[model samples]
Target: MLTLIGGGRDRTGGRGQTAAAAIHALLREEILSLRRKPGEPIAEKDIAAAHGVSRTPVREALLRLADEGLVDIIAKSGTHVSRIPLADLPEAITIRRVLEQLAVRGAVASATGSQIIELRAILVRTAEAAEAGDTEAFHRADEAFHEAVATAGRHPGVWALVRHVKLQVDRFRRLTLPLEGRMARVVAEHEAVLAAIEARDAEAAAAAMGAHVDGLSLGLDDLKRFNPGYFLEDSARSDLKRA
Candidate 1:
């Protein structure tokens, strides 16, 4: 059974969706944050009880997660969170590196002095969030920092593509965030990228951004070492076990 964070289901939906959307968002966040571990069973009855909803909405919510590759739904079998697909890591990292490098280069070329200052201000807040050990806050700041760059670069649409590609990467990051000094290392990396941007050196910015994106791949080995069960070898996952 899953425990609802932030006071259960009543607190979640507001904009017209009272049941289905609320449950969907809650479950999606749990999956992305690794609160709901890979391959874990999602008990619809329990979720419905916790959220004070019927089984219908819970089922709908799980279906949405399934479409997002976060869960598997079988006709007669039970639903389970999808395990990390190791084979896809390289492709995801490559996509991020390519797009972010392009975005950072444009940012360096197009960002005004004030925009550069705004980016640094985001880093300062990121530091504070890291120090406070607020993972959600830190994650938000990190996203804001990158989105700021994309916006400054006048290619905000690029971020939508990055976001779609990075869903798996986000799960991996949640697993690694608790590692010793990981947040600090991220701050330093952001600073390096920002320094190049501040200098208005497109080549340096692209290089720095590439390095930062590439560093994410380095965490994969660590993730496999620490949470072997959460991921599946390419051949092992052809048919995932039902939870």
Candidate 2:
């Protein structure tokens, strides 16, 4: 029973939404941090009890995670976290590169001075978070930074696609965290990307985006080796008997 600070139910709606969001964050963090063993059955009752919530919110959160491909929902047995499929990496990386490049170029053109400052703040904080080995903080700062860039661009389509790729890429990225110095390296890459964006160098930003996603793809094999059980071959996941 681990408790996260500033975490848990938000009761404003009185619909157990805070509990749902808290449970969702916890589960996703578990998956992302490999705290929840891959292919593990994610029983709704356990989660609800853990968060002191009802079945409804717990189920709702599971459904949302399902949409993000994080969990497989079943009729009788229960929800189970999805196993990472190695073969899908190439497609995911390709999609990310295309979408993020657009995001960077568009953001560079539309960014305000304040928006660049916000992006820079996120980058610096992300570096600190990574150094501290605070995976949760690092992940939040990383996503927020990207969202900032997309928002700066005012390209809703690119933002939507970037969101899609992120959901798909997230599970695998979790697997990458244990590689020594990897998180710091990722932060450094982000610094370079943001610098390009701030300099109004659209071409550099686009190129940096390509390099960033590709570097992540390259890091996967090393990560897969470190936690071989955390990833799956599509053929091996027929039923997730083991992950």
Off by over 4 Å in 2: 1-30, 51-64, 73-79, 235-243
How many clashes in each candidate?
A: 0, 3
Window of ten residues with lowest summed lDDT in model 2: 234-243
Q: For residues 1-243, could you state the per-residue lDDT of candidate 2 as single tens digits?
A: 324312455633445557667666667667756677677878767666655667877787777777666777765556677777677778888888888888889888999999999999999899899989988888889888878888888876776776666654777786676578879888888988998987899999998888988887767767767768766667343452221
Which lDDT values do the candidates have, in the order given? 0.83, 0.75
- List of clashing residue pairs for candidate 1: none
lDDT of 2: 0.75
The CA lDDT at 75 in model 2 is 56
By lDDT, the best candidate is: 1
Candidate 1 lDDT: 0.83
Candidate 1 per-residue lDDT over residues 59-150, each given as its tens digit: 88888887778897755688888888888878898999899988998898899888989999999999998898888889999999999999
